[model samples]
Target: MPDLASLVTVPALLASVFFFIAGSVGLVRMPDTLTRIHALTKADNIALGLLVVALLPQVGSIADAAKIVAVWIVVQISSGAAAQLMGEVALAERDAASSGPDQRGMAGGRDA
Candidate 1:
């Protein structure tokens, strides 16, 4: 029979892989940029965190685990910020595209 370490790490790693696959499917099936970002940031980040957790038991020391956790935390924060920025840009692009050159400014003394 396998040991406790294998039991924990195996499932955790499997879960991480599942999340990554789900995120990829979501990205392809989704309609637009905002949705894709949602899939990636939410699903992929979870996958990354789980991957870190799975590797934690195999690391040489507690300090290595701490470092992994720190990296994961940083990734979470940065990904959230990036998603927000991408969302804003997507909205801006949509607005600009809808406006068109003529609608943007029809001129002060001209009629539609």
Candidate 2:
């Protein structure tokens, strides 16, 4: 008979994989940069948490699982910061292009 742990682990792992696939699709199909970042960060973080849960039973010690969870937390924080930074950069670029001086130089100047 299959052990209870094995049974539970299987589904959790599978769900994690599904989340990964969904996130990937979001990245490919989303219309814009910010939306893509939202998909990747949120979905992948959930998937990572699920993966850590599924892996806990298979690991030799509770300490190992705790370590995995800690890593996931760190990753989530860093990735979130990265995504925010990228969004800000994109916005700045957009603003600069939209508002900057024209190719003709000063606003009152005419073609040479």
Candidate 3:
């Protein structure tokens, strides 16, 4: 019979692998940078969370689990926020590019 620890670890590892694959596909198939970031972040967050949870049983300590969870939370927040910021920046750049060169204060235009 398979041991409990093995059972837990195996499933967790499999889930992490699946998340990684999904993320990779999204990164490749998505049409834009913002969409790609969304996919990548979701995959990374799920994979890391699963991996950490899998390690909890092996560590066999509450303190270790707490530390891992804390780190995971930090990673999740930082990555999500960074992705949002990047998306905003990309959108701003796209808008600017589409606006064309500025015509203000040129050819005797008003300069107020």
Question: What TM-scores do the predictions have?
Answer: 0.82, 0.79, 0.78
TM-score, prediction 3: 0.78
Residue-level lDDT of model 3, residues 1-112, one tens digit each, is: 3377778888898898899899999999998887898899989789988888677677667898899889988998898899999999978876665553453423543222
When summed lDDT is taken over every stretch of 10 residues in candidate 3, the lowest stretch is 103-112
Itemize residue pairs with steric clashes in candidate 3: none
Estimate every model's Cα lDDT from 0 to 1: 0.85, 0.82, 0.81
Candidate 2 positional error at 91, Å = 2.1
What lDDT does candidate 3 reach at residue 8?
A: 89
Tell me the TM-score of model 2. Answer: 0.79
Comparing 1 and 3 by lDDT, which wins?
Answer: 1
Task: Supply candidate 2's per-residue lDDT for 102.
Answer: 72
| Per-residue C-alpha lDDT of model 2 across residues 12-104, encoded as one tens digit per residue | 999999999999999999987878988988899888888988987787778997898888889988988998998898677666655565753
Candidate 1: residue 43 Cα off by (Å): 0.6
What would the per-residue lDDT of candidate 1 be over residues 23-94, giving only the tens digit for each residue?
A: 999989998888898998789998998899798877878899899989999988998898999999987876
Scored by lDDT, model 2 comes in at: 0.82
